[model samples]
Target chain A: MRLQDQLLFNLRSLSRQRFRTLMQLIAMAIGVFSVVLLTGLGEGGRQFVMAEFSVLGKDILIILPGRKETSGGMPPLTGGTRDITLQDAQALSRLRNVDGIAPLVVGKAEVNFSGRSKESLIIGANPEFFIMRHLRIQQGQGLLQIEIDQARPVCVIGPELKKELFAAQPALGKWLKMAGSRCRIVGILANSGTGLGFDMNNALIIPVASSMQLFDTQGLFRVMIDVHSLAGMNKLSKEVERVMQERHEGELDVTVITPASLLSAFDDILAVLTVAISAIGGISLFVAGVLIMNMTLISVSQRTAEIGLLKALGASSRQVRILFVSEALILCLAGAVLGILSAEVLLWLARQQFSDLLFIAPWWASALALIVALTCGLVFAWLPARRAANLPPVEALR
Target chain B: MIQVNQVNKTFQLGDQPVHALNNIQLKISPGEYLSIMGPSGSGKSTLLNMLGLLDIPDDGEYWLQGCDGLALDTVPMDEEVRARYRRDHIGFVFQSYHLIPRLTAAENIELPLVLAGIPPDERKERLQPIIQRLGLEQRAGHLPNQLSGGQRQRVAIGRATIMRPKLLLADEPTGNLDSHSGAEVIELLEELNNDGITLIIVTHDMDLGDRAKRKIRMVDGEIVLDKSREQEPS
Candidate 1:
């Protein structure tokens, strides 16, 4: 038979059993839908986490005081009682791989500007801290080196803090009181949005010296280091560890986190998550495959006489097999198309609701879905097609 | 031409083996119209099925046009080859008519041609004449359920002979039809036989057997009587 005529005949045969065909298509759609949506969400979550980490300076490294033994466990902050000193920050800055260092003292405090008072995190660091942490100054001037050297009582307010403290009023040059100590706001930082629901722009920045004096946090510090490149991060981390070990005589504790290491660790967690999700979703496809196999087997049994007639009339076993597989493939293709469209709609709705976060369907994802659908079709349709093809015409006809 | 020599066929129904055909021997020439008549389970249908290449005997040899029927081994023929042979060399007229219910008369007639891999143009070319000759030109568009028994039988005949096979096997071709429709189907088969096609019919109707030039009677899987007209047509 002509290829076109064969296809038309197969299609007509499927149409004759519309309800069964529709059920198979629906099963395939559900399979593909689960795969697409779950993978999309996993990918979207990965991108969101990456974006949040990017705001902390891609080349930056964080060093805490202590370490956790197990992988992925949170490391304890070292020197919880004795904080990192500015001298240590300066000493780390002198390292070859280290680009810059910012020693910070963070504490929760209530601040008042004009008539408004709000609780905010206060980070004390020098002017270079802005560049080290990817902070952008929106108004006035940032804390200067001279101000840090002189221990000036000046601070920079994040955009969220500015809105809470000043509302419509000017925030720059305004006086804000923290712990009953008045400090001049030198600049208002641009909004940095939220990272995993924590608003990064709801913090206050001040000179490290002034913070130590105001919060009575002497000799204690949290130091952030910006590295020159990711390639030498491991070696640099070891070098810093050695230096800190030697400098403290093994008594001073430190925890170091480079962006590359953090990313690799995060990727490890994501890999596990992706596998778990895919395995769960894969079960759905497996179930759908079983459904297809069951339906095809039943179709073979029900259409035994028709198959016998076709065989008697000159259809090859190969042709019979192709006809049934073609039916399954058509069903899967239809379901895949519908499933993809539904997934797109679902992702679009998610994007609409969570406008700040990004959810994108990469080209590779679409290609993967297509490949998966075709594979599922073939795998699921094999046994029944074989059974139909191997039937003896004489016996089948009788 | 067909030849049969000591053919035996047995069916294993659970524990006991039932002999459906036993030591059967028969011969038929081209253009011969033969009728096989017997009571139920008399092996008439079994003989017809063996002759149609739909079954193979467990013993003995049968031949069609010098091709061995016993050792006629082609590895049980692939579906394509069997279908091709069925389309190009053998035609079947079943008691039930067995028309594909969903297809129109013309489409059903075109089925064998389709299976034969005939091009649409050639199929149409062959179909138009046969349909016109069968006086089914007007009913070509009607489905089997929409047609009368006679019209449906005509459509079935058109489908059976569309490829112009050499042998025609009819198994109770008129069993489900009225006498008038039955007579019409018999006439159609006779007309095709006149056109030089070998015909083998199985029927319990003695009157149908009498109309054939040769009649073979079977009982209990063995032929009890074989007779042919002494006066051959000139």
Candidate 2:
């Protein structure tokens, strides 16, 4: 018989049992839907974090104080560890592939303005800190003093802190008490959204020299460096570590985290998360496969006489098997298509709800869901199809 | 056209072994019209099914020709070979008028040609004359349930002869019909026999059996009597 006729006949037969076919299709669609939606969620999360990393500049590297290496025990009490200092930052800025660098020091201090006092975080940095962090001054001039002796006792107040302290009053050029020292507010920072670790809208920014004097600290907190290119990020990170080891008396204590290393570590973790959820969804496809098997077995038993008639009309066992197998393929394929379309719709809808996070299922997730669904349907339909094909015509007719 | 030597078949019913065919010997020539008449459980239908290739005898040296111009060994033939021959050479009519329920009478009539892999135009062309002869034109689009017993049987006969097979086996062709439709169906079979196709009918009616030029009476899994209108050969 022609392939067209075979398909037509099987379709006619399957349509007779409408309820069973619909139920099986739904089960299959749900299986595929879960895989797509969950993977999309995971993939979306990965993109969101990568975007967050881009806030520090794609080629930027962070230098923290102290070595990250773990040893068997603590060091001797008499020994003192070296801290990353401003002089080291000034030296690293002169190296090759170094575009710019900002030495940072942060501390908690009490701010008393017009008899109302509140504790706030104080960020200590110079002119380059404003450029690298992308912070803008909306009201007055930003930090401009670059030398320790020339740096005056001036501060930039975040917008939220400006509201609480100065509320409907001018904040720029106003004197506020900070950590037992009085400093004049020089700039009102722009209203930017949250950053990596802390909210900048509620903090204060000052010159690194003044913050060092106020906190009485000799060690710098961390240094942020911007490179010229992607390749420069790698070269500068290695060069900075080598430079730091030498400056610290051949002791590699500072840890330099490049964009490549951080992003890749996060990528590995998120990819595993995507696969784990997809497998959980795959269990539903397995259940759908079992439903297919049960329905096919019932169909075979119900159509025994019709199968016998076909056999007597000269259909071979192989043809009969093909008919049943193709029926399963059609069912699964339709459900898979439905699942993919629904997943895309759901992802689109989710993107509308949370524009901050990227919501997109990877290409492989859809392909894997489709291939797995079809395979499940095929395997589940095998035993019943074989049973139908192997049925003896004489007995079946009787 | 066909020869069977000492064919035997047994069915195990519970703990008892029932012999459906006990060392049966039969030979049928081309263009012959024959009938086998017996009570129930006498193996008349079983014999007809064996001739139609629907049942296989346990121990039989059976030879059938006129398909693909090659003689076929019935005993050792596999399912594929048996199916090919069944499609190419044999036409079987059951008492129940086993037309596929979903197919119209026209589809049922052309089913044999479809199985034979004939193109749609050729299948339709070949079926036109048979439908005219069976007088099923008015009922061509009707399903089996919509047609009367006589019309359904005619549609089945049209399907059987659409491939122009040499052998036609009818196991109780008129068993489920009234006398009027039964006679009509028997006359249709006679017309095919007159057209030089070998026709064999298995029935319980003695009058239908008498209409054949050759008559066979089967009892207890064996042929009790065989009679021909004119004495010819063994």
Candidate 3:
């Protein structure tokens, strides 16, 4: 028979059992939808996190204190003191590979504005902090070098804090009480939103000199260094460790983390999460496959006599096999189309509701969903098709 | 033409062997109308099935048109070849009619031609004359359920002869029909036999057997009597 005729015959036969065909299609669609939506969510979340890190200039590296060993066990914050100083930042800035350095001193404090009090974090850094972290000033001028030199009581407010304190009013140049000390808001940083459950835009930034005075935290520091290129992160990290080890006689207790390293660790965690989520979602596809197989088995039983007649009339085993498999593929393709359309609609609705907090599905995700649907079709239809093909014509007829 | 020599067929059912056909020998020539008559459990149907190539005898040397029937004995024929044989050499009219319910009369008639890889144009070309000859032109688009008993049998005949098979095997082809419809089917088969096609019919009706040129009586898996009318030389 011509290929078209075979396809037409199969299609016509499927149309005869519309309800069963529809059920198979629906099962396939459900399988594709679950897998696609779950994987898309995971992928979108990863992209969102990566975008958040990207906001912190690609060349930047973070250094934090390592957990120290104590008498009984390891303590949360009992590390050998690194005591990173202004001298360390100054020296790092002079390195050929180092573009700039900003020593940060952060602490929690209460801010009062017109009798409205809110607890927020206060960050201490210099003017170069803005460029090193890629922070943009939304409403006012950023902190200047002269302000840091003169120990100016100036600060930059995060977007959320600006909303809480000013509420539609301009926040720049306004005086607010921070930890019982008055500080003028020099700049309102643009909204960077939240990442990893922390609101990046809800913090206050002030000059290191002012923070040191207000918190009585002199000579204590947490430094952030920006390198000229990411290609030198490993070399620069080793060089910084060597320099610090020599300067402090190998006594400095600090941890350095490069964004690439952080990304690799994050990817490993994401890989595990993706696999776990996919496995959970894959169960639904397995169920859908079972449904397909069940439907096909029923179809084979129902068409047993017809199969015998066809075989008697000259239908080969392979043709019968192809017919059933093609039917399954058709059902799967239909389900996949509906699943993808539904997933896109769901993702769109979620994007509308969550805005940028949730990520949108990429094109490759849609393609993967289609591929997954086709695979489900073939895998699910194989056994049933074989069963139909191998059935003895006389026995089937009887 | 067909030939058979000492054919034996047995079936094993749970350690009990039942002989379906035993030491059967028969011959039929082109343009011959023959009938095998017997009661239930006799070997008439088994002989017909073997002749139709739908079954194989456990031991036999059967020949069709000088071809080695035993060569086709063990190996199951592929669909294309079986379809070609069924389309071009054999046509079967079952007791149930066995019309595909979803297909219209014309579509059913076109099936054998379609299976034979005939193009749509040729299918239409071959279908028109047969349908017209069977007086089923008006019922071409009607489904099997829509057609009367006689009309359905006529459509079945059209389907059988669409590919111009050399042999037509009718297994109680009129068992489900009224006497009038049964007579009409017998006439159609006789008319096709007149056109140089070989026809073998199996029936419990002795009157149907008496109408054929040759009659073979089978009992207990063996041929009991074989006779030919004086008008046909055999």
TM-score of chain B of each: 0.92, 0.96, 0.91
Q: What Cα-based lDDT does every candidate model obtain?
A: 0.79, 0.85, 0.78
lDDT of 2: 0.85
**Predicted model with the maximum TM-score:** 1
Q: Model 1 Cα RMSD, Å?
A: 3.4
lDDT (Cα) of model 3: 0.78
lDDT of 1 by residue, A304-369 (tens): 777777776657788788888888888888888887789889989999999866776555555666
Select the stronger candidate by DockQ from 1 and 2.
Answer: 1
| Residue A181 in model 1: lDDT | 89
The residue-by-residue lDDT of candidate 2 on A167-260, one tens digit each, is: 8998888999987787889898899756666578988988887888888887889888878778767778889999999998898888999767
Error of 2 at B218 (Å): 3.7
Q: Model 3: runs farther than 4 Å from truth?
A: A67-96, A146-151, A168-172, A194-200, A212-221, A229-231, A247-249, A357-369, A379-382, A390-392, B66-83, B231-234
Candidate 3 positional error at A325, Å: 3.1
Tens digit of per-residue lDDT, candidate 2, span B13-102: 799998888899988888999999988888888888888888899997788985666666788989877877888888888899888887
| TM-score ranking of the models | 1, 3, 2
Model 2 misplacement above 4 A: A66-97, A105-122, A136-139, A148-153, A157-185, A188-203, A209-221, A227-253, B14-16, B39-41, B67-70, B132-135, B145-153, B174-184, B204-213, B229-234
